[model samples]
Target: MAKARSAIVSSGPVGFLPVSITFFMAILMLLPIGSGASNIIMPHLVMISIFYWLSSRPLLMPYGACAVLGLCIDLWLNVPLGLNMLLLLLTRLFVLNQLKHYKGRNRAVHWGVFAVMSCGLYLISWILFSAIHSEFWPIKPVLMQWLVTAFSYAPVAFLLGRLRRWAW
Candidate 1:
């Protein structure tokens, strides 16, 4: 029992990378990019971080940590409560379920998969917001955000892969 407890305690340091990186990304998203359209079209840094960690190191990120980070993002961004939390949780689940197939795949494959998933995520967000407001939200901004997010995945994933190596 003592050995088991120690083993669990030892995993905490390893787990710190995903949580810290995701939290840092979420905080960074709060920074002002620019005044009008630029801000609306900015990539979802936290979402990218979450997906990267979920794909590459699901054990490190874990569902609970993702939930907390998502909630933090929702509160900080002042969007509808639980919006990000649901999205992150769903993203994590999808990535985890598909991880077996992704193993041994090249970076290009990963990027392609991320692009599709990110688009779906943005679409879902648009639907949710429309439902909440009882009217259809303009999708141009969502499309722009999705495009930026999809294009940004490769570079962000590369950086995150480096971070994972350093952490390990």
Candidate 2:
């Protein structure tokens, strides 16, 4: 009988490209784009990176890396610890589960999946924030962030695709 493949065994060896690119995206996201209020609409560059790499190159962007990146984001954003960790982890899981269905599909279909995933994740963030504060947080900002992030995915993916190609 063929030996069953475990998670670590199935994934290819980790490398510098994925880690560096993801962290670069994270730093870009953490930068001050504008005034404090404007930051609310800042696209989630790091999340987009995570989603792209997880889908396009799952072996390179493992769950442990996702967790670490999320923790770093949580620290940078000053939100409750583990919030981003949870988000990124969920993104990893969701993308991996749906990989076979969407792999090699049309770009538009990938974008649609990303849109839906971002919407759900943002909604969960809003709900979690409200629960933490014991009140409903204004969801307009959350919605705006989601809109920006969803719209930004295509270009970000394009750039990362180039980087991925270059690295190999």
Candidate 3:
């Protein structure tokens, strides 16, 4: 009985894993690729991390924590304050609502859903940026961002999955 209890406790969620991983990924997203490519091509690593954790361990990553991580990203990227916060919060809510359907689904299903969510995220971001700047920004960058983010999801999910298994 004691051994079983220990096993259960060991497999339980760790509070720091979500926050630290999100923050680390957010910081990584801010790093330059050194390829001299435009910033638009940079993948939103933080969003990928958020989605992974929220899907796998929702309780470990609360909405408030998501907001905080968003704020950090916004500040780090020098974007308008609260922009990332709102988006991250919305993403978290969306994933939480859809998580039940995802429970027994295959990885391909998760990737498809993530692609859809990434599209919505880019669209909303473009709209918000246009609204803030009072001018329609070029759509090309947003499209590039969406593409890069979508393609990068597989590797990010794989790494995060490993981490999740290790943590649990």
**Per-candidate local distance difference test:** 0.84, 0.85, 0.85
TM-score of 3: 0.89
Model 1, 8-127: lDDT tens digits are 744877667778888888887788778775444557888889888777666777788879988998899899999999899888988988889886799898888888888888899999
Candidate 2 residue pairs in clash (backbone atoms < 3 Å): none
Q: Give the TM-score of candidate 1.
A: 0.89
Better of 2 and 3 by TM-score: 3
Clashing pairs in 3: none
Q: How well does each candidate superpose onto the true structure, as a TM-score? A: 0.89, 0.88, 0.89
Instruction: Count the clashes in each prediction.
Output: 0, 0, 0
Judged by whole-model lDDT over C-alpha atoms, candidate 1 comes out at 0.84
lDDT of 2 by residue, 85-159 (tens): 999999999999998999999888899999999999999999998999999999988998999999999999999
Please provide, for model 3 over 23-107, each residue's C-alpha lDDT reduced to its tens digit, 9 standing for 90 to 100. Answer: 8888888877766564346688888988988887677778889989899888888999999998899889999889998876888
C-alpha lDDT of residue 156 in model 2? 90
For model 3, the stretches where C-alpha displacement exceeds 4 angstroms are 1-13, 37-40
Candidate 1, superposed: residue stretches over 4 Å from native: 1-12, 36-40
